[model samples]
Each structure stands twice: as structure tokens, then as C-alpha cells.
Target: MSDDLTKAGCCAGTAREATDHPYEDRARGVPPADAVTQADLRTRLTEIPGGIFEMGTRKSTYPDDLDSPVRKVKLDPFLISPTTVTNAEYARFVEATGYRTVAEAEGWSVVFHLLLPDAAAHPHHPPGLPWWRRVEGAFWAAPEGPGSHWRDRADHPVTQVAWYDALAYCTWAGLRLPTEAEWERAARGGLARKKFPWGNRLEPEGRHAMNVWQGDFPRHNTADDGFVGTAPVDAYQSNGYGLYNTTGNVWEWVADRYGPRPAPGRLPERNPTGPCDGLQRIQRGGSFLCHVSYCDRYHVHSRTRNDPDSSTSNAGLRVAADL
Candidate 1:
């Protein structure tokens, strides 16, 4: 489950008992789960029905850890936030709780060197990925460097928040991080074996569905999707289940600790929760910097690992709840 932040870059919804959106798994005759509406779904939480679905991939997926072998994962009904927490939302939590993020405590964080202003220079680089740079005071509020602020990005997903920080936010909000299995199932959006959340095609019929690197890797970004870095949480189309930014946004922290897939040729796992213990926790979804030519780990099944206290320009969180 160990992965490199050298690659992890970082980056909501409402309504309906999930059963209403059976269109996602209609092909397999998957019926909706019981209907129990949660009267007060925080701001924007979608109820994802419990059901069995495939996890991991069988086809080609690059930069894929490959440690998570293909398996069937069954989940119970639960409510989950469709988008990652926005800066405005996090600010509210901070104002109410006087909470300080790990990045703020450390006084520095990693930012894409390309994104930082010229004055915010740091000689350090992660070898081949020179785009990543350490900057002083580059937490979520100051994403690029000390000069940056979330004022202009109030609606964008909050970045530079570590796993411990995310857990803290969840605790304050009475929410929890989705387990790796729950995350994959939600990201799948009820579709079967598709590459991206939408389908096998990256750009269906020549239309960009989500935000990721549009041009060359690191060197350039065409911004064909109208965004170069992080886009609004709901920037693209939702999958059949109506979850936004499940893929190709920011690498989101999940509930599982880093672990290897079961031994080769093992049976399918049921409600699998990752390994007993590890230094790094799991992160799902790729970031704006993910390019097929380089990382290519932005697909639905893609995942990586990072230190629980690590924060960067590309990491964020999505909250979930039990139903």
C-alpha cells in the first residue's frame, strides 16, 4: 500500500435515497436497497445503497499499485458526500473549533513548483518530478505559497490537508472517511469494469468529462476542460449514482491503512477493510498533475499510499456516513 507523494497531487451533492438511481447497475438487474431517508443529510450527502460490485481492475491501468487484486466487494447502505470538502466548508469548521491543520502546524507544505509564484522558490525537487516543490506556509489557505489564499477558491476542494487533519474534520462533523472498498464502489458509480467513473472511454465522443492534465505531462496542460489546476467540486458530470469528482480531481484520503492485496489467486474479499496496520493510509482518485504519459493513476480503481500526517498541494478528503 506504500506509494509516493512524488505522484500524489491534490485536490459535494444532495438528494434522493440512492435506490432512485438504479440506472447505474440496471444492466446487471441490481435492485435498489431498502428505502430509509435520512431527514437531515448534512449540507449535501447522497445515500449510497448497499450492494455487491467489483473492486480493482482486470484490464490495463498504469501507475496502478496492482497490489489490490481484482475482487468483489459488498457494502451496506450509507450516505456519502458527493464532493470533497471545500475551503469555505473547512473554514467554517476551523472558525467553530479553532482547529489548526497539520500543514499550518508544520509551517510548510509541498506545492507543485510550477504553480508557486516566482518569489516562493525552493531548491528542493523530487528528482524526476521537478514540478513538486516545498514552500513555506503552503497549507490549504495558502495553496501555492504564502501569498495564496482560499478567498478566490472558496468553492474549490480544500488541499494541503493531511489524513490526521481529515480525520479531525470528520470527527468534528460527525462523519468518517469512506473505507477503500466503500470508496471504490462509490467511485464506480454502479458501472461495471469501466475505466473512468463514466466509462471505458477517456473523452467520450470527444468531450472531456472530468478535469486532469489535458496536454503533455508536467511540461504543459492544454486545459481543454477549462481548468488547469483544481476545478470546482462539481466541475464535471456525475456518474450514474450522482457522485462528483470521484476521479481525476484530487487524490482523496480513504479509511484503510496501506496493505497488499490477498495472495495471488485468492478468493474474492467480502467487505474488505485493508491491512491490520501500516505507516501510510490509502488515497484514491488521481490529481490534476496525473497524466497518462506520466502517472496515469487517475482511473476509478487507482490508489496510492501516504503518511497519515503528510499534506501537499494535491491531497484532499471526502466525507461519508453510515445509514
Candidate 2:
């Protein structure tokens, strides 16, 4: 992979795995057959009225990302959580079901090199992406590996979760991961053909709207956005729909698989779920690790994909339900 692709992938891009990894077989997961939903789950969700909105971009920055040829997408009304699942929220799920995350089961997950207290101790790096380090014991609870704890970051979006893990959480809650079309609709916040949830300008009125890389990516972050890592899930201004941190705090797993996108004229008119079968699942928005210089995927229309079994420090989940 090229350096740009590798670096972008390190943020919201696909995960590169080695064939010899010990946990390869154990990474896959399925929702529990007896999953139950909490009665109060919908009370905290924001209702999105069904409608048609333009999807994709006419001005494409990354061609390979396939975010072009703007098309109209119609969605059914649905309810979505205002924020990505928080560390505290996920802890409740784990405690209730005694569910073990893939990272915890496999003994390791990918972590940002800068988050490591001693980067040298974890010498393994994914090929072409030295910024990503394979760290032992780096699950959602121990976000940065063994010594780090999620107690202090209870409000922050939970990370190091695989797509299947998100699915498990959704099933248990009687909710589901939002379809890629639904995600874009919620992220757009009723806007039309804009680059971001708020508007085209990134930092509207000289104020940082979301959490994203402020300085140099990978090597240095100026922390101009008041965060170096994951921000509180409720951090930054809520979009028009009252959804918080939809783009830059972390990449959120969606229901669709990476696609054989239909031609613009052939696009599905109502709630398109993308392809029925694929190896990788779609993840929308971007992460704290994204920057214009390397990975500019924080926009509402932006997207990327990774293997369903892959786990990373900058990926997370949000829930949606039929209204």
C-alpha cells in the first residue's frame, strides 16, 4: 500500500492483518441468540423523520474511497442514539451479559503508537503503517494497553471494538447498527450537499466544531481541538439533529458491507443497505487520528471500510432503531 493509503487506513481505513497471527480464528463473533432489549433504550434516542437527501460528493478528495457522483437517498424514519456508545454504556452491556470483546479474548488489538506509554516495548507494527502498534491487552477497558483504564474516560466513546462486537451490542439492545444511508442522513443533520454536519467550513466562526487532528498527523498533534485522543462522546456542538460527535471523535461501524456500489442511476431509492455480501464492513465518519494532510475522512459524506473482525483504538459504534 502507498504511504497515504496506509496512513489513512491507520485512522478510519481498513486493517491489514498477517496470516500467521494467533487470534485470526478467534476474531469472528455472532450476536447471542437470546439477546434481550432494554425497555428504556429508545428514550435516549433522537428520531430522524424519513426523507430524501443527496448522498456522496461532487467534489471528491479520495477517489478510491468512492465518495462521488452525488445521488439522492431516501431513508425510512428511525431513531438513533445522540452519541456513539460510551465507555460507561458499553461497560453496562459487558457487566450484564459477561460478554468478552474480541480484543480481550485474543489478548491484543491495534493501538495508536503515541497512546502507548512505552512504544518501544510493542515493536510490532502493521505493514506500511508504523503509527499503528499491536499492543497486548489493549481492549476497550484498557484502551492503551495494560496500564490504561476506562474509568477516567467514562464519557468517551468506547474503542478497540470489532464490527461483530458492535453487532453483538446492537442485538442485545434490540437496536441495530444504522445502515450506511441512515448514518449519512443523521450525520448531515438535515443539511444539503454540504461537506460537514454544520457546513462546508471545518472550523465554523473560528471555533473547532469536532475532535480531529490539529497539528501534524502520526508524528505530532498540536491539540488545537482541546483533545489529543478520544474526546467525551458528547464533546463539541451537536449537529442540527442533536447528534453529537458524529464525525471526528471516532469512526462508527454501520450496517452495510463495503460495496459494489450501484451506478448513480441505479441507486436504491429507499434505505439502501449496500451490498449483501462482502469481506469488510462499512465504517462512517472518521477519527481523532484523521487530518487533512493524511486522512480527510471526517466529513459527513466520507467513508471507509475494514474487516469485520478487525479492532482498533479509533473505531466505535452507534445504535439505530426503526421508529
- On lDDT, the candidate that comes out on top is 2
Per residue, candidate 2 scores C-alpha lDDT tens digits across 149-223 of 999899999999988788778766778899999999999999997889999999999999999998877899889
- TM-score for each of the candidates: 0.84, 0.91
How would you encode candidate 1's per-residue C-alpha lDDT over 1-323 as one tens digit per residue? 11223433222000011122222122123222223312332547888888778888775454346534567767888778989999998887677667677667666777775676673358655545566776767788888876789988999999988777788777667677999888888888989888888899988999988888878767678888888889999988998888999988788989898766675344456667888965667889888877878777888988877767678777799999887
Name the best candidate (by TM-score). Answer: 2
Candidate 1 TM-score, C-alpha based: 0.84
lDDT of 2 at 241: 98
Q: Report clash pairs, candidate 2.
A: none
Summing lDDT over every window of 10 consecutive residues in candidate 2, give the lowest-scoring window: 1-10
Please estimate how well model 1 matches the true structure, expressed as its whole-model Cα lDDT: 0.73
Clash count, candidate 1: 5
Which runs of model 1 end up more than 4 angstroms from their true locations?
1-43, 59-64, 263-268
